[model samples]
Target: MSELENTFNFSELEDDGLDIAAIFGDTGTAEPLPIPEPEPADAPEDTGESAPEAERSQKQPAPEVEKKDAQADGETDLFAALAAGPKEAAKPARNDQKATGQVSLFDKPPIFSYGGAKDAIEDTSMTFEELRIAKADDFPELAEGKKVSWTVEYGKTTKVIADPKGTTIASIKEEIEKSRAFLDALKKAKEKDRNPDCLVKPKVTAQSKGIAGYKGVFSTVEEAKRSDKTICLIPARDGRVYEFRKTEMGDFIAPKDNVIEFSAVRAGFTPALPLIPRDLMGQIISFFRCFMNEWEEFEALAHIYWDKEQEEYTVFIPRQRVSKARIDADLRGSALPEERYIHYADIHSHNSMAAKFSHTDDQDEKATRLYFVVGHLERFYPSITARMSCGGKYHEIDPSLVLEGIGEEFPADWLEQVERCESRSDTLLRKKDFLHAFAALGDMPEESRL
Candidate 1:
């Protein structure tokens, strides 16, 4: 028997048929190791400096023990590998199961709580009392019998009223009394009803056509004849004409009222005296005399101004700047300085002819200013005529009224003086000449007249 076999109990092992040699890696059917080649002649001698090769060969694994040690080591490595395999993997599942169990047990999500200087507790078995409990250090020190009172009151409100300026208690009371009185009066007024007939207007009309504020249409002859509104035209039934309205009685006779006779009333404008100072009137006369003497032309023109600020009438001898004719005349001057004074009157001469307003004169004196025509210059006392074209009418004013404070060279009654100075009546002579001229023309045929 081998010494190794003698050292261990082999009888029981042999009866069990257990291969002990196999466990120890002693395979009976083993192959021998290769032998080394013999050294050549004349080979180099060994100095024995290196260790023996036998010892190297001895340190190498014996084939019989290699498999045995490998088997034992592999078993141990397998068990250890299993133990080290993904420790984090198994731990997470266990932790998740524990977390889920805790959530389900508490009927709420697992919450982590932190408290002052304490380790975290993840156990689900914690009770509400344990969570609510506080450490001794967390409470504050207090007196044994501290008292407190809290009150809540209801059913009351506060309001702020703004006081008006200049208001007193007496004024406020008076206003309240006035308001009550007004209300009482209004209530009493509502008790009485208004009459519908009282609210209606009366349908009344005036009797006289001349009276205004009446409800009818008719010719107001008396009122029109009395009024200052001059009527230019008056028609007749039998084609007869009358130029004037004569006063027969209290009521007046108009131009068309009397159709039987051919009569004439006031033909031209009625005159109104303008307000002129005595001194200014004299100056105006002197200005005309001087102006006529200066210019011996058939006709001459001049402008006179009334300065309201200075209260004086001044004459302006403007440059003629026109081609004058023997019988008729046209004149132009610079723009009158109306800003300084009113351009009140315009005067011109007719050089020994009759004092009359011409068609050109009508156009020239269109504005509201007094106009004068001086004629009968051959005689010592010349004829003077004054008029104003205002509100669309030639209003003849008395020459005496306009030239009030003049020297006695002019006549007081100029119209009478003009008649007496003439050799014969001009109107009769003109009528005689017109009849002779018509007689010479002979009677026209009826169709020719039409």
Candidate 2:
């Protein structure tokens, strides 16, 4: 034995199933075996004792660990694997989509990458006058009037160019790119000018969703009335489309009149601005009664204008011909600048009658304005009703929406002043004292009736 072999017992390592001679020999000709990995318990928990002490302690090997020919066979198996040639990787299972040729739909030319050729197409069925043209400097590659190929990517116009590499668009200068983007937007807008696809179409849902789909939209009322869609939408001229609906009584494209649904539980009118002052409302009522007659009714017209600078409302009485039944006013408006004093409401008196909108009032109040009617002028407490009219349609609104409201505030101490007795007014403001004296007209003397 050599001095190195004699230095320590290698028989202990061989007992652990490792061949000492085979592993240390030169690997120039024969392939070296891969050493088998040790299992748990071969190197037990650390103890202060040495290897010889551990053998004396009688430590047991784990179950299923055959510390014999199993290691020898595993070592041979690893060497045999290295000596053999590499096997091909397993092919993935086919999904059988090739039979239907659907794979071609996902296939693309190796060079085209941004998107498919489908993105290059645009519906040019309707075209307006050329809104924009590529500037000469921005597009030096494009000829003035010759046909050119271009597409909008993320809304920016990009021109196809040939390159030494795969197909790609040439990089534009920063300034030129911005200019092209502006022109691209204009071009797209012009394309959608009269296109039906670009026009908003009303959608049908389980429940009514306002005008988005309830009415067919159009550029004009005339267009809406002539539309073939079941419902239509017309631009409200305020960036939103007007809701025009089809009615069974024939005006399919009629201007929709919204109702201020009166609810006993919920608030019907939520005020958007301050109410008209009580002093101004009193002036309107007193002036309206000036032309009141017991036998005949006279309708007087006046416009309520708002001065934004002063933030107060002023009445503008137009020159008119007044009679027992009607008043014809020259409503061409005065020399007032509309920019400052906006005519917000048109109010008229129904004299001694109940507050209501008449046919003549509806016909004349076609312009968009708030309309008011002062009725029961002969009574101590007159009635005033308010409504809004727009595009020849009317919407009844709570009079308190704009008016300062009825009744005056009494002194807070007046509540304590209420004694046992309270005197009632005999002015017959509401139903009159006739109910107490007489049930019907025949119950009263002929001379006692008005």
Candidate 3:
């Protein structure tokens, strides 16, 4: 038993020796290793001697290890990496850690209090009171007791959010006043209902045919002679053709004729004049008396002037004269001729002129001279005149005698003058130069007869 125990003890001692050998091999021959000194937190003190190449190699690893330690502890290695210059990139951040929560300046509750007081309460809920306080605090300067009376947009419509006082109401009233004034001025500018001062009234005349004394207004003598009703002549002051049936109260109104009244005159008025001839005064007086039934009520006189060069006679009846004549003629029983006669000197064949005066439709041997007995009285007495000259001849007067006279021996110069007169007359007629032709006749020499 003792020998077996000695053998066990010897084996254990050998096992212990082998373990010690293994440890020595790993620790580089089993000497006690010296501890390394920690680097100073401050910058290293500079030495006069340059560091050895081996020491520099060792120092490079020291800075890198220190930088890694700093980054692991959440310290920035900005200076260490900057010292590395362009050779190294900045270290990447670690994303495994939980992030710190952010604190917002807007999240806190406001300080203002409103309504009834209550037990202290948490301000986590977004209540109306809490919201109002938050708004006030956000715009502290502008929100201090300053109600939002209205909000005015730069280019859009204004909005009235809160009426702290009557400021908005006052602004609205001012705008309404301006609008009303504008409307008043617009109404004045329209001036819609004003009446015109002047008016037009037409007068008409009625006439009957074969009724000797029946007076009428007719554009032509034949028309006057054909109508059965007592002719009423209503002359138009405006020269427009007015129908008798269209006139209101036409029957009660007396027919107006001869003299034109001042009230009846209008803008662009032109008077109609007679185209016949007689003693200048007699022709005018006769025209007025025949047409004007109220001549006695209005005294009127006709003024006549001869334009010898024009071979025309112009008659002017003044307003005063018309009024006076209306009074005189209306009272007077005798009626004057509405038409007048015009006579030209007989100068054709002297013998034929004499023969024409004696016979009706006389065909004389020397010349074909005609005579005319022209007058307003022709309707009453067709044979009032004996001899009259026309176209350079004398003839027995007839109502329809258009050609006055003819001459077999005309002077050569006289023929030329006649030709010129005929040409001028033709041009005047074509151009509707009635007024000019009348003036031309006056320009002709008295001796130059045609």
Candidate 4:
């Protein structure tokens, strides 16, 4: 017998010889009960005993009525017969149905009534114009002949390309990507814009402000970095302030005052970065290192809070409540405690796969302040990509900037173990090898792992 089958003995149950039939009545098929026969009618009672032959012959028979007279007066005879006494009850009409299970034309089936007075107020259908109006937002479109020009900023009202009539919110969002303004804005340390040109912005005022007063859209870097700031500002009609700088040419022909320096406003508020100690940074690195060799993805959540005694911000690594993990990991919102911390950061490993923020992730973290993606986890130096969403814009920030007191080099053993486990031909075949490597490190337990 196999080790598993031998480990559990089920022979005792069979030896018991349970009597299922006796316990729950006879198991043999039961005979149907016979229907009883109907009772016969009772005989009438005799008045007297049998008489002699002479006495019986003297008895007279009942006089019969004339059939001709009765036939002549059938109506009178029927009345006379009815007045005499009530006759035996006539047999009831046959009530047996055809039993064909098909609906009969003669049958009157019940009908359901689903309408009332309220139904009269409802319209069955709507026109195309009515549908368009119902779906439209408050943004007004420019007239046919009217044309306007506006500069594209990553985090401002200039993010959108056109009004509602010209394009939809989804189409304008595509422009944000094609324009490549998001990366440029990050490089310039500017605000991020959700809407590009062809897509519609979300309904929320904070999300929708990026394209509020947009007229003409400038998406290309060449157009955005145009030397002539006056032209870009002229179309916007905003009171934009600018500065002039002296070029190689002397002030005689082209003066410094003629040049424009900048024509945009800075953000009003920016999220503060937390101070992560070297120990916490190492802990976070170690936590992310667990999935370096695995083909699947894993995620972690870090809560940042102010340490009252230390007078510095500390990083709190909470238990990851991951809803799902494969190519991408979705961390459960319930894992994050509401009252404990006002600021939190979500970090996830991408397992050397897709490194960019997916559309789903963008929607999920649109309001998050700090988010990081660790890719190429099996490499010597892991790939770290971090972005901060604040003031209605996303800005790319370096890990070194936020993660302080951390050296570039990681432990040699960590990299070796990751590489060795990832070298397996089939990840499923070497699950034990991966587990043993982490177990040897003694950083976490098997039950607590992803």
For each of the candidates, give the backbone clash count. Answer: 1, 11, 43, 13
Please, what is the TM-score per model? 0.30, 0.35, 0.11, 0.28
Which candidate number maximizes lDDT? 2
What TM-score number comes out for model 1? 0.30
Query: Which ranges of candidate 1 are over 4 A from the true structure?
Result: 1-296, 321-333, 405-450
Best by the TM-score measure: 2
Tens digits of per-residue lDDT for model 3, 377-446: 2133212243433343553443223222322575778656553346776886877777878789899998
Measured with C-alpha atoms, the lDDT of residue 8 in candidate 1 is 32
Model 4, global lDDT: 0.41
Ranking by TM-score: 2, 1, 4, 3
User: Where's the lowest-lDDT run of ten residues in candidate 3?
Assistant: 194-203
Q: Residue 12 in model 3: shift from native, Å?
A: 99
Greater-lDDT candidate between 2 and 4: 2
**Model 3 — TM-score against the truth?**
0.11
* Candidate 3, residue 389: lDDT: 38
lDDT accuracy of residue 118 in candidate 1:
31
